[model samples]
Target: MLARTTDPIVAIATASGRGAVGIVRVSGARLAPLISVICGRSLKPREASYLPFRDAGGEAIDHGLAIHFPAPHSYTGEDVLELQAHGGPVVLQLLLARCLEAAVESDASTGQPRLPGLRVAQPGEFSQRAFLNGKIDLAQAEAIADLIDASTEAAARSAGRSLSGAFSQEIHTLRDALIHLRMLVEATLDFPEEEIDFLQKADAEGQLATLQAQLGAVQQRARQGALLREGIKVVIAGQPNAGKSSLLNALAGAELAIVSPIPGTTRDVVSQTIQIQGVPLHVVDTAGLRESTDLVEQIGVARAWGQIEGADAVLFLHDLTRSAGTDYAQADADILRLLSEKLPAGVPVLDLWSKQDAAPSTGPVTGMSLSAKTGFGIEALRQRLLEVAGWQAVPEGVYLARARHVQALSRVGEHLILAAEHLAARAQSLDLLAEELRLAQNALNEITGEFGADDLLGVIFSRFCIGK
Candidate 1:
């Protein structure tokens, strides 16, 4: 769709429930008349004017600010009106009802143009319209949603950067390089006689190499941004009395989990979100894994294994004191090896030697010595987490991204490799190269919804809260 006509969509733009202020937003060609009817005064465009909200009977609902934005300059590229009112649940509902009523009444009048009587906006519809109108691209639209849903300051800032076009600039740079190479290939295809020679030219091959490298760099940074946005889940697993709970408590900086010297103290997984250098570490503290006759202990161990398999990282905690020449020590080591085999390749495994307060120097191996009591090596652990998660502390602009973005980038990487191979072999694979390039472009488009299907937009925007 190139652009959308102003259809006068209205929604409570503020969050639902009680707040300090709530906004009832109306947009379309009919916006001015609707505001006049609701506020009993014509609103000056772009000016925030104090106005009293009124009911159909002319009874006051509450007084608040009213701001009008004229068409072609507003968020949706249409005439927009905002009614800010005291944010009481009932008061906001009344305010919204008044706006809807005013819009319906205005639409029925002559010369106003028949418009939808303040139809409820679909999730992200306003932003979607902005995207369609060229007010913002697909990436910036997605970034607006990301900024709203961000769970950390880092993620929020990243989304803000993306909204401001930082991410798009990089993607476009890579895309321009791809376009240049595609043109070169297309030019060669026109002359069959020189095709072989053109394909083998050192300059042609070097250009492709450079394009691939640029795509690779962007892919790496995008992956890091994805991790920052989506977060990584880490599971803490080990034999009983392995300081599993202690580690959890230490990471949480609170008594989130009960830590005792007694074996099998925790019979359930305790989870918490820890931010390390702006990356969220969803730490799951599971019951220690070991052979147990008790049904409860066995169940806990099973749950621990379940967590281990699904985790992005696993902190395999081992009690050095318990492993000092004991029968349980050998059994524990065997369990650790088994756990290692269960992990997927590329997922990091950290050996955490806990209970450092008692045995501060002893560990199963060169594993990190961490104490729940003294907070030793905790900073190092934080640094390790940032490293494992590929989080950079450098203030280079970052943005939150979903798994969809990663999958697209991965496909782009694959296409780059294939293109490079086709070019290297001096084969007439222009068709394949073009197809890959198109696929790669489509995948990138999904990041910003450039080629987003209506259904995909529906699914994405449906996740937003009603009245957004």
Candidate 2:
């Protein structure tokens, strides 16, 4: 985690495995000598040249394409070298070692190391350097990782937009507006006895109203973006023979969970990830919730409740066919009571009546009735889940956002609201109004790394894969 931007660093740039080609990337202040020693020739800036990568013994380690990027024009705003060789672990490792060896070896005449202080790059060190070098902001740096790890095509495209400065631009616009408003407020403070009605003349109140509306719009988009990034976790819970497994299979479009008429057939949790309109849904099918004598089933029931507690949503499946029976009614009432007392707050529970095809027309029915065997009411159920999740239809210019961004925007909104309250006091509270505006701007600045702590930077970049 101790990353020095000045140190020359190298890492395998591509994924680990046998492929058609693998890449070894090096970034530093000066890489010309390292390139010459390893590639046997100085590379032209930004041009790919076919060369033989050599070792300290002057033996060819691999023949590959060498490309050089000079300082201030590279991804990290430093001199960079890339060696694309055969995609074998051994070959890549040899090339990586030679780069390190060349950096430490002394030059014959100068008696100085060819490339001093070369080291293996830490996870996300490359992107962190890019941020430090003014190549990209914090939000854009995070987007780079998000783009690589995106699960769906929509998520990838949204991350691309964020990386391209779409999200940053929106933040910049809001910050600029706040700055203008702060300037107006501060100007009035300089002259108290002028009686010029500065606040009225400058339309400060109108501007504040507009800024609040714009912030709301941005927050709406950010929430949708966050949903696309993190998705949702859903746990399916019900008594044995309630068609919980069948519902799981229906939603996944495959037999992911075992389904049988025997009670307690599922004695463990089964999970599957399925997407609904590009949003990933991690679905977990747990053991049937009921009184059991077996030890394993008891353990599974406990685990099922554990999963429910941590879930973003819960699907409480009820056997519609058995709704008329007194014993079934009593069991259902017990499960409801348990859910009322034990389920986590804010997690939406969908009451689904399964086996709609065989259910007798009882007097009054609650919740959606669906037959997993026939795929009936499945689409409605999917839509309901999305609604509970606060997901909206994908809109144009949608960009990827994280929970941190949403929280920052929320803070900004709070500060702006407080600023408005101070502004209502006019000249008496001008100083407090100015302070609120400044606070709002600072929160917005954190989103783009205009103001960020060292510890925050470390935590962010540490999650990135090496060579990113």
Put down candidate 1 lDDT per residue, 243-306, tens digits, no spaces: 8888888888888998777889999888999887778899999887878899998998888888
C-alpha root-mean-square deviation, each candidate:
2.8, 1.5
Screening candidate 2 with a backbone cut-off below 3 angstroms (N, C-alpha, C), the clashing residue pairs are none
lDDT of each: 0.77, 0.90
- Per-residue lDDT tens digits of candidate 2, residues 1-468? 437778889999989989999999999976877887888878888999998899998889989899999999999988889899999999998888888888999877578898899999999999999999999999999999999999998899999999999999999999999999988888898877887877889899999999999999999988989989998999999889899999999999999999999989999999998888878889999998999899999999999999888899999998888888899989888988898788778878889999987764642267898989788899999999889889897667679999999999999999999999999998788999999999999999999999988888999999999888
Q: Tell me the lDDT of candidate 1.
A: 0.77
Off by over 4 Å in 2: 360-364
Measured against the true structure, the TM-scores of the candidates, in listed sequence, are 0.92, 0.97
Instruction: Give the Cα error of residue 16 in candidate 2, in Å.
Output: 0.4
Q: Give per-candidate clash totals.
A: 3, 0
